[model samples]
Target: MGRGTAAGTVCFAVANQKGGVAKTTSSISLGVALSDLGYRVLLVDLDPQACMTFSLGLDPDQLERSVHDVLVGDAEAAEVVSATEDGPDLLPATIDLASAEALLLTRTGREYALRNALEDLLEQQAAAGTPYDFVILDCPPSLGVLTINGLTAAAEVIVPLQCETLSHRGVGQLLETIADVRKMTNRGLQVRGILPTMFDARTTHSRDVLDDVAMRYELPVLEPPIARSIRFAEAPAAGRSILRTARRTRGAQAYADHAKSLAGEREAAS
Candidate 1:
């Protein structure tokens, strides 16, 4: 494969079965930030809400094809993948994706649906010789069939954890679910790292949560948690990454640094 079709790509699904954790934002920003460092990336929106798609400036309602269609065998993955100006390419989603869980029930080997759909994309990359350095799949905040597909396809997992007691409580259970997925589906899957988000350094509670989480997780916590930023909240409205819409903002720098550091870690590991 020579790092093309067989050497294997870093398919990290940014997942956490919890909402409001910056999972989608981290997925989108990390894709672009990594792309900025000269790596080809593909961000797959597995969430039926399609927040990642809409955030990147695409109208999920108007799309002719979505990740759901690809999962249900209605269309090819290449048909729905669109280019982004910065670095990552997007395989958008629409609300119709919600039906995918029921729609694919009758299909054989249903859990492997997304992995199957990625075949053409992988082959194309192999032939073009521009193999993607990373493919970030943004999973919904649930352990449903859609997330199952992502678990089946990915080589690693990147979880965005909110620095709050309630959110932190879910991590142990989430890791157990990952273990479940590994036992039956993706043994290759590993937790690349846990990224702490929305942290306030001034607050004792936030700092305590950060330390608690780091002490608990086996994987090293990526340094520099993403600070609470309204600019990050606003970037999606402008249909761009924080790196573009809020380039000079601290939120943008934090995410950018996170991505760069992740790449460096992977390089060193290899």
Candidate 2:
């Protein structure tokens, strides 16, 4: 992969195992923000509820195929992927994905199911000479089979953390889970960093919680905490990311900066 080149696809899982942390929002925003910088991006919605799908103006109920189909071996990933007006491609999700956990449990080598599927997808894309530059996995709010598949498939994991005491509750559990994944499935897996979301600089408590979290894990804290914004909640209703809906807002700028940092990291790694 060349420095800042779009040739190599970088897979990152945005996970927290805790709902309301802006996991889906971060995935979508970051994907689009990267696309804005001219990278071909793909966002995978691993949540059965399909918030990411619905956020992009795609109706999960009307979809004939989704990530669920791809995971269960019923459809190719290319068949389910759809282009979004926001510029990134999406492998959407639906309620059918709720059955994936039970289905994967019975199969041998189940943890590698997504890894195998994604590898085939990437190979097919590369053969055609139109590979994606970034693949962002939006994990559900639980560390189950689906989340494990993401952890297994990704080269790095970005944890979207809420700046609250209760929000930090799952950090330890997720780290322990990642430790297990590295030993058993993905040895190269690394935590990209913790992204503080839904932040409020007005309150000292938020700042304190952020400090406490950094000390707890000694993990890199991705900068420019996404400020608490109703614009985020409004964007989904408009079928767009904050980058599109509130382009001039601090939230949008934060995501754009985060994307730039990610690109710089890729170039440095290269």
- On lDDT, the leading prediction is 2
**Model 2 residue 208 lDDT score:** 89
Candidate no. 2 TM-score: 0.96
Off by over 4 Å in 1: 1-8, 217-219, 266-270
Per-residue lDDT tens digits for candidate 1, residues 1-270, read: 112236356677888999889889999988999998988889999999999999999999999899988998888888888997666999999999999999988888898999888867787877887767788899999988988888788877888888888667778888888999899977767887778898787789987877778787765677778888889888888889888888777767888898888688667655
lDDT of each: 0.84, 0.90
Write down the RMSD of all candidates, one decimal each: 2.1, 2.1
> lDDT value for candidate 1?
0.84
